[model samples]
Target: MEKFKTKIAIVSSLTAVMILAGTASAYAAVPAASKGQATEISAGAKADKKTASPEEQVYNLVTKLQPGEMIAYYIPDKKINLTDRILFSGKGYVLTDYDAYTAKAAQMNAPSLEIPETYPKDYKFKSGVLYLKEPDESSELYKKLDKQLRAEAAKGGKEFYTIPVEDGTGEASGAALTFVKGSVEISLYASHVKPPKPMEGTPVPFSNPDEKTETMVIGGIKCTYTTAPKLKSRLSWTDTSGSVNYSIFADNAKADVLRFAKAIIEPEAK
Candidate 1:
């Protein structure tokens, strides 16, 4: 059983790495579209040769993702571990773990605005900040869960968060949402200020030599970041046999550190 647990951890870790690598490659090739940039509907329509709803367009994009590769369309305010039923296209899909992919997407998609402070100001001790322009709010689905979310926030230590709903475009046609997940609850933080920087002497939780961390320059600003596999025990379980562990961590500046922490600790779905 111990051996089996070890094998599971190893395989899960490798799978996560592969998925992340693939996602990174795909993102690099097709840079995130500018928010409210019409989603290239005409081009997309021509490509698909059919008119599809926005969700369908997103679904098409998701289908392009390789197995183990998931896309995040929202950014959570705080770090959280989410174990709820993810309703995708009226189907209930469980997100066993959370990834920093959505936060990364936000950073990639966000326009280069001037940095307000030298240090990251919007930094959460737990999760990373996801910045979205005001005006992109209006989700029938989210409205359904708002009350439950408020209740969870009232009970939270370090739980889940939702990015303030807003219209991504000035026209108020779309809504922006953030999702943070892991072993704990997820929270949402929204701010007009710049994100805070990593404090000096602050211990970084994950680091890898073979997996070198890199810096991303957005709008002429360089953000320091890294990715590494770290052992997570919170999401583990012990039977009569023994215990099993997981691999998760902070991989980028825009990543939800808290969610990454939870992912590292949470068990992978069998």
Candidate 2:
């Protein structure tokens, strides 16, 4: 199972193209470190030594990464001038303000998304970010990004899985809400549409073979609760009645996790 997951992770890293789009003014200010810096292509990469699209820039940087080297970016609240020559930050548009985060979700048309009215008292809302898939096939950047991914896969002697690039229409189809208390954190992910399947393989199941999983109905919703040694507990369910999918994660969470799921489910049930 670990080997299988490693294979999937490798292929996914090669193919996953996260393109973040939305109004920057919708969030807060970008940190100085990530603000408006143009991405520098590595000397080993074959990218043209000229201006490139934000997507292309990110593709070059990500493909050039070694095992341990890394880069991170933050979005500031303001209008993003994509046409302007600047390095796009990381793949996600993170919003620190609750109102801005929810506003972004609404903009993404996640009307079916519901938030729990209450959670563990010690946990405080941290931030939220939208998740974007690869760029649309119709996009020119898609051609370049796909080429880079295929080239990277060949360099590693791996099969390149070409995920069908859907016309996302520039709207994020999913988002995650995060809450934190000291060292512990929880994440809740939501999406209206069913997730697309991998082009060539079965979808990876959330439960690992080493994990203990429980299937139960809570607050009229059937949920799968999973736990593994030294791993965060996870609870996931599809509210078929409401047409919304949800998952929650946290450390050593069991009863509190169920209570949290119930908190979100009960509100919708009412």
Query: Each prediction's Cα RMSD?
Result: 20.0, 11.6
Model 2 CA deviation exceeding 4 Å by range: 1-90, 111-114, 135-168, 193-207
- In model 2, the Cα lDDT at residue 14 comes to 13
Best model number under lDDT: 2
Tell me the RMSD of model 1 versus the true structure.
20.0
- Tens digits of per-residue lDDT for model 2, 129-165: 6654334445675555445444443454321212222
All candidates: TM-score: 0.19, 0.56
- Candidate 1 Cα deviation (angstroms), residue 32: 6.3
Q: Which 10 residues in a row give candidate 1 its minimum summed lDDT?
A: 86-95
The global C-alpha lDDT for each of the candidates, from Candidate 1 onward, is 0.29, 0.51
Error of 2 at 238 (Å): 0.5
| Clashes found in each candidate (C-alpha, N, C closer than 3 A) | 38, 5
What are the per-residue Cα lDDT tens digits for candidate 1 across 1-270?
244223322222222222222222243223344432212322145365765433444434443433222222321232211223211211011122224533343433532111122322343223222222222125553444444344544555422223222222221111112232443322221213223333445556754465545554333323233444562211111211222111123223234443333232232211
